[model samples]
Target chain A: MSRDENAAGRTMLEVDRLAKRLGEFSISNVSFTIDEGEYFVLLGASGTGKTVLLETLTGVIQPDSGRVVLAGRDITRERMQRRKLGIVFQDQALFPHMSVGRNIAYGPASSGMKRSDIEKLVESLASGMGIGHLLDRGPATLSSGEAQRSALARALAMGPDCLLLDEPLSSLDSGARVEIRTLLKKLNRGGMTMLHVTHDYEEAVALATKIGIMENGTVVQVDTPQRILTHPGSEFVARFVGIRNVYRGRLRRESDGTSLFESGSEAPFRLETLCEAIEGEATAVVRSEDVTLSAYRPDTSARNLFEGTVSEIVPARRGAEVTIDAGAMIVAMVTERSVEALGLERGNRVFASIKASAVRIIEG
Target chain B: MIISRIEPMHLIFAALGGALLLFIVAPLAGMFLNVGKAELSEAAADPEVTGSIRLTLLSSMGATLIAAIGAVPFAWILARKDFPFKRLVNGIVDLPIVIPHSAAGIALLGVLAPGTPVGSLGERLGVTFIGGIAGIMAAMAFVSIPFLVNAARDGFAAVPVRLEQAALNLGASPLRVFLTISVPMAWRSIISGLVLMWARGMSEFGAVLIIAYHPMITPVLIYERFGAFGLKYARPVTVLFVAVCLVFFLALRMIAGRRSHVEG
Candidate 1:
């Protein structure tokens, strides 16, 4: 792990082995860092302690152990105001008693900025968030999207060194989610370091410069989004990043410089792949989108092809999920048009083809 | 016609509740009706009655303001913190409301009497809490602090913890968050609490009677006038005091309502 290379840029936020025990839920030995200007996403499912970790970073929850270093200073014991970390919650949490403008102005005004300067700053931030028309409106009257923008403006008004977002887009509709996701990306491009937590894989992929997958109170994997999606470190991460087909297999090196992969003892089937063969038990991961479904096994240079029966077909977003039982269950995501054209359904015979490069191997 | 939707049993219950309302309103209305306009005017012109009314208003307001300084923080803690015996503390704060007012007076006098330790401490500080405005305010505050604390606690509880956290994240100190976010958000409840405490303190007789009988609050004056003369003489002062209370209470409520509306 190139820690020095990763630390080459100014580290904006570092959470080192932070642990907190809250009732039955606990954040155990969590550690991660965000470099300057990086949009780091902590990706996890519900009850995975993502919010707790974010709270710990913000000094809202005192960690029982470990340090939170922000901009090279340890802020584990510092008060939340002195730490200067801003957060936008999923519900937006706008002060209902305050107007939009006043809510945004709260930070600067409390810090003793001149009245005129606070007004100007509020105007600038509201306009920047596209909520200038809403400044005079009460927060209770704003729609969810409007509230989210106001919350963003309020957090940005503080000019915080880094922003912590706890599922900031989770409560928005699909349209609003896209809008805020774009806004987040735009903010990141403008050199604002962000630590965003979400359970949505699409959000992590769409916004993260670095992705950390958290599970059961600990970070299971941390890498770039593309790397994490393609080459997950563990089965939990492999499934979490939407790699639908995971098989425990034995890798046998063929004499022809190919690797023969066999999965399942009851009905063993072999797949040939053009990669370096390691002779050991391993877990093979293939993304649902990486598997191509065909009515017939056509002649192709693709190294792995399995003839199987479609056991279930479920409609998914913009596509259909077809689960194929080819000795081991494999899920393939195909377009709805493909599903119709191929006449795919439960109990239909199909061929699933995967390429050698698309097959990821995790050694045990 | 509006009663057409009501069931027979519900109508009976509503009639009973209405009778209870009448039982409370009749005496006050009868007293107001019995007091002639000339008698009310005479009572209003009397220096002692006016002075007592002024004392009642000022001392009650003073007690509320003084108690609020301590009670608001205590309420915030009760709402937000998880300390051992918190429920007990809450119940103790409410004990004054349940105990007899005369008993409260006895308890206050035991601590505030001239020879008591607290009285000695007050003497050293050049402040006395017996037969003085200080004693009257203390008695009023002792009976009324619960209203402010309990209501403020509920108000603080109703405020979302996340909103306070959001303010803190925006670089507001805890105290700043309390004042700017928590208190303002809970302003309606706190204002209602203050009004309730003030009104309760103004009407206090048994406690204030034991603590300070010389500086007569309106309730004591009404009692004294009733004892010395009869219903006719006391009714005019009662009507005047009740009218004053109703007017000021409504005004305060209007102010609170308007402020909340504007802030919202």
Candidate 2:
């Protein structure tokens, strides 16, 4: 089944409140679900419990609490071999002593498959992974990409129910990273349920159908990549998803059913927002691309408009990021064409326009 | 090639290292040079000498085979596990290597000799240990098993734990993982350890002499000849034994090295 077909499909792997403590780092109350064919990416930074969570799911590190249900079966305390979850580690961890063929055959052979069947299986897996010719070669002789392919084929030899990937692209060059990424996408499209953990947000955004953002061992938010980028659930998630302008302040509910976000203490400013939060401390996330900048207060119905001086204009990939210092600091992304047309520079007065709907408020 | 300038300090260090090397080689070279072809042939032809050499080889091989059955697993445990007093267990494994072989022999005798608990148990089982072939093997194993354990442990420790995990994830049982991944990856060190253990066992004299005086091994025979006769009588036998050991050691090393290359 394709990812779209499995969007509301059966849950292949359900990790509910899984908790584990390894030395000082801990994974606490982590929960998520992967559909039969959905590619789930657990995105977190270094020192987050991504690795620990993967280990717990793979049955390497037993969790202190919670259930890991695979295909409606509780596998929280199951043996790693019986869990039927194939894992590709960060290092790829191929058997150095075995040829690519033997490495791929290892899983099938272990489960008492016939010699002919194992040979056929190994051959098919090698050809499928584009490593058919490399089957006769040893792991040490293969390139990083080839080794990774061999590792993947070896993991898939047993036809696991779910594949777990731990930073599969962290060690690869950019070219190999893209190659493996395409391969992973192809594999997932072929009805393989995958739970890939990575610290790179770009990888998560590019590959994940749904991303779980982890913080301090707990999954803070689980949403689609677009939703995470457009409307982050927390300040950490906002900053992690590359939202440049984030402010922690108080949200006051107006009688008119609009919420006003008040930020900064010394030079406090309020931006009218359209969130359901009534009144409390909140985090206001305004995407840099959502904020428009002009030389003067142009005619517009933008609810949150302010006149400020452009304090910094740094060149970004798509355009220039213009940071303006009004009563509250605001960052806007203006293209190079706009920068030239508006004669935008440092210490220049400009009007930044943001609609009330552009402001997303999350409880702080 | 690039020629780098050498200083007086380099010369001094090189001379010291050369002296150490010369010290190790001088005695072996002198023995090889002193032995006459006629005398060497005579020693090799002697039934007593040949029988002793055969006995030594067989006993050492038997000891190595028996020790490896236990040592390899123990070594793997030592390599992979983290428990209380692990260092103490490691120290005890190496104790046989550090202690005097004669003292080791006496310790073995105390356990395996008649009237002791193990000795009485062996007596009940009709397995004589003292002054028997079993006693010789016991002595050899007591003094030489450490080499195998230490080498095998080093080999196992070098293997990344992730490979084992990867194998386990592939639905291999723990035993299958050990046999398929751990054993093959650590095969080189294990072979090297077995060879070292066998070589050490073959060269054991004081321990074997203390335990089994009858069915003399090559080392005990050499000592006997040296004590009964003189240097001239002992030199030929010693030279022949060394040559045999050198041949076997080199052959084993070449085989093990070639196999590891093939495996890699």
Candidate 3:
């Protein structure tokens, strides 16, 4: 809902309600904008219109509906040639017939630059992308990280209005993924307006200034990564951001005027909720990380505490996520060191407590 | 688990191809062995034989040029488009390849000999296919059309459509993309096709024999000499043609290697 399209210059790219169909798959009613020098990320699962959205921006595809406005000009009708948007495909799609220098120079040549200027620009970009050593080499000889950087260099050399990348790091190993992602960050830092798309939640959280979550071709929510993850408007957005604890529950007005909620657990839990309890029941949700794991009862004014067994530990990069089995399922994160310190293991009894403030209630 | 001995199928295929190779190569060996210095000198000394060779090269080049021009566009279309009766059109393009060379010759004669509207129109345009260079080119182009078109089509097909889309996104016109990306990417295939079309056109005989026997291309000359003076006299020209073709074939192979290296 927050649109800051007006910068010192005109809007770089504005997509208005774009719709496209191929086979039974349809991408409909999609609209978004990326301002000058803004880093916008489209995050979704595979086949969720991320690539189609990028293509629609690049003019490789003509949407069945909607107009694409770039720099205050309607580019929906412009041929792909005239649109001048650069894209890095998931597959590098490098021109195998061309050497790295020639590949980078392709864009400048198409832009009608002089040959010497193109050569000079290519040299500069190659150096900047750290591929100057490979300028004479073929694209096949480059590693995935190197190829992605070359792709980035090729797109940048074209002097595009904006960059559209379709999950450029998805194919790479973790190390390569980190490397390409850093390169993308550097591009954004140096004033390249980019629409980077990915299916990875953490990658979007790391690289995006603004993130849009799309489902079935419609963008359901667009916000900062924290807002989408912590305060998701719907169960769909919450689950998509990997929040593991969402419960359909009934809210009862207790004697003290506090809300008591039972989520099909053995006992009802109490929480402060803004949603009216006049409706017999509502939805209660909590993020997995919002629940804190402890060896004993967490003594706090904070609301809910439950005794449970440490059921499983799912390994993650930053730490191990502890899944505790109470009357209701609960998840909490503890560092691997903490897991050891607390002697947390499967079937070992533990206590989990979630702050009342962290509990979110939704009316559906 | 390796069976080193030749399998029955292998032996059968080897025998079949060996017999075919023998049929093709024995005559070359026999023809050269039979021709002495006098036969060679006589074949070389004859002004008509040299003239026929020269005319054959010139018109073969002409036919290749025409085929290249037509085949590039036809190949692009065939590689890119889908339409009703597409397979039939593809089959038509390939017809000359399977038709007996003499059958091709009769077909060319039927189409281009001064009777049909095409032949009359050609006459009106001051083009004659009988007893002239024009007739040799027509026959050669007819037989070689499939070779060029099919090769170039495969080349174009080998290029990903995404590359063209990428070029277009980078702001090159459709024509520019074809010239800059599509054609260049497939240039190896196109060149191979051109070479094939050229060689097939160069060796055209039965078709040329039927349509224009008087303007003697090397093949027609070879046939005439074989009929008139027997094997010894025709042998020198046959060996000369083989040498010329070998030189070009080797050159083509080298160029292909160089291109692969460059692409790599």
Position A228, candidate 3: lDDT? 72
The digit string of per-residue lDDT tens for model 1 on A155-244 reads 999989999898999899877876887788889999999999999876777688899999999998899875787668987887677776
**Top model by lDDT, which number?**
2
Fnat per candidate: 0.89, 0.94, 0.79
Q: Better model by lDDT, 2 or 3?
A: 2
Q: Compute the interface RMSD for each candidate structure.
A: 1.3, 0.9, 1.4
The better-scoring model by DockQ among 1 and 3 is: 1
TM-score of each candidate's B chain against the true B chain: 0.96, 0.97, 0.87
Off by over 4 Å in 2: A1-7, A244-292, A295-364, B1-3, B124-126
In model 3, the number of clashes is: 2
DockQ values for all predictions? Answer: 0.58, 0.68, 0.57
Chain A (alone) TM-scores for all candidate structures: 0.70, 0.70, 0.69
Q: How accurate is candidate 3 locally (lDDT)?
A: 0.81
The numbered model that scores best in TM-score is 2
